[model samples]
Target: MISFRPVDVDSDAEMEMLHRWVTHPKAAFWLMQDFDVEQVREEYRRISEHPHHEAFLGLVDGNPAFLAERYDPGHVELVGLYEPEDGDVGMHFLCAPTDTPVHGFTRTVITAVLAWIFADPDALRVVVEPDVRNTAVHALNAAVGFRVVGPIAKPEKQALLSVCTWHDFQSATSALPRLGASL
Candidate 1:
């Protein structure tokens, strides 16, 4: 079963685990590989305290398995990053490091995150800006109902803008499989 809870970044072990995940090679696109542990700690602290964003620890069968965050595009992630459109919400996610990748894990993680976001009364759409070169995540995002809106040049890299409105998400995923029995 998969579930999400607000992360307590001040916790020592959780912070350490997050540090390792962000520094891993699989997390290269996250653009935090060169960050020190303290930087990661500080980043999490800021996110935890940010009013327009939220960070969550995802658990599968009671074990921490992923990290997910949601932000209002007009506030945090897309603040001056893009021309804000009404109802735009941004999202970021990173799966825990694992030697053996499991089938359907990405699908489950995204589904759980989407479920959580849709639970918010004011949320109207989900948006993502992943590096265009990250095909794996592009596929995962598409699986979860995000349709590419085109590429946007960023200071760091070219990002593929994708979006999923509530209606589109509902229509596309209505018959799709959910993450686990818990979802």
Candidate 2:
């Protein structure tokens, strides 16, 4: 089973791992290709300290397997860009880079991340604004029941604004294959 723990400034080693993952060519959409470990650490440290945002480390059998961030869309990522609902939460996730591929690993990771988000009792919907060019993530978002609202231009990049309600997620995943993970 997988679990999530809050990210904190003490996680230097995990920060290094994330630095590598985000800098990988496959992760170009992360937009941190040139970030060094210190830069990555400082960036996440800021997130960890922010009141409206949070970072989490996804653990698979106690080993860090991925990263997930959740934020108040009205306060942070989507502020002034989209009309955020009262319980809308913004999300970002990154699975660690690996040379060895596991069939359905990314899908499983995303499932875990979504389950984690929806677990919050106050959460009414999940919001995402992945880079417009990130087709892979677009498909993943759709599989998780996200419906594209439109494109929005942000300071960093053009992004596809998408949202998923709890009912939508339930409907989408109910018919799909189940992946095991507690998140």
Candidate 3:
């Protein structure tokens, strides 16, 4: 079984682990595949300091296995991309590269992410802007309730802007665990 818990991304040790995950080829969609350890550290450092953004390390039973980010779309990633709703939140996630891929691990990670985000009392909807080329993620986003609003050109890459309301997620994931369940 897989279990996920969130921890702050403040220590050098945590940054080091995240650097490896973000720079790996599997994280190319993350657009940090060319970054060195220090670059990764610096980038996340900025995120941590930003008032509207945050980064978290996801541990699978105490070992880092994924990264998740939450941000205010209105103030940060999508300032002009779309109209900002009162309770809209932006999100991004990356699964750490592994030699042995666990079946449903990625799905589990996404479900946990959505559940965690929606758990926030002020949050009413979640937004995502994954690279348009990332079809695998598109499918995963769909599975978790993200409804595409079509492609939009960002400074970095073409993104498929999508959103999911609380109802959308709840309706789409009716068969999944309620919350606080292990993967």
Candidate 4:
């Protein structure tokens, strides 16, 4: 089963693991390619204390599998960038990089993260603004029923703004096998 625990400041070791994942070439859009462990920890430290944002470590069968971040788009990352809906939440995730990647692992991680978000009764929609050049995530987002609203220019990159409602996610994933089946 997939579970999540809030990320904390003392999580240095876990931060190291996260550091490696984000610095990998496959995670270019994550924009932490040059960050060291301490930098990562400090970054999360700020996130842990932020009222509008929180981060979690995703565990699959009790082993850390990925990092998931949830935020209030209206107050945090997307503030003034998009029209805010009452129940909208923003999300970001990074799956652990592996030498022997399991087929469908990344998809499973994203599905689990989406499931976790919608589990919150207040979450009516999930928002994402991934770097426009990240084609892999654009495809994944589409597969999971995220519709691009348009492009938005952020300080660091030009991003494709996407949104997914609970109904859309359910309809899209219903036609497929269960998310965790591949793992």
Clashes of 4: 0
Choose 1 or 3, whichever is better by lDDT. 3
Of candidate 3, the 10-residue stretch with the lowest lDDT total is: 1-10
Assess candidate 3 and give its TM-score to the true structure.
0.92
Tens-digit per-residue lDDT, 1-183, candidate 2: 788988766777777788888899988888899999999888888998899999888998889888889999999988999888888999999888889978878878888788788888899999999999899999988987899999999999999999999898988888666544554
Question: Given candidate 3, what's the lDDT at residue 176?
Answer: 86
Mark the regions of model 4 whose C-alpha exceeds 4 Å error after superposition: 178-183
Worst 10 residues of 4 by lDDT: 174-183
Clashing pairs in 3: none
Tens-place lDDT digits, model 4, residues 49-103: 9999998888889888888899999998888888999999999999988889999
lDDT of each: 0.84, 0.88, 0.85, 0.88
**What is the alpha-carbon lDDT for the whole of candidate 1?**
0.84
Q: State in Å the error of residue 176, model 2.
A: 4.3
Q: Tell me how far the alpha carbon of residue 166 in candidate 4 is from the true structure, in angstroms, after superposition.
A: 0.6
The clash numbers for all candidates, in the given order, read 0, 0, 0, 0
lDDT of 2 at 69: 91
Better of 3 and 4 by TM-score: 4
Model 4 deviation from the true structure expressed as Cα RMSD, one decimal place: 2.5
Can you tell me which runs of candidate 3 are displaced by over 4 Å? Answer: 1-10, 181-183
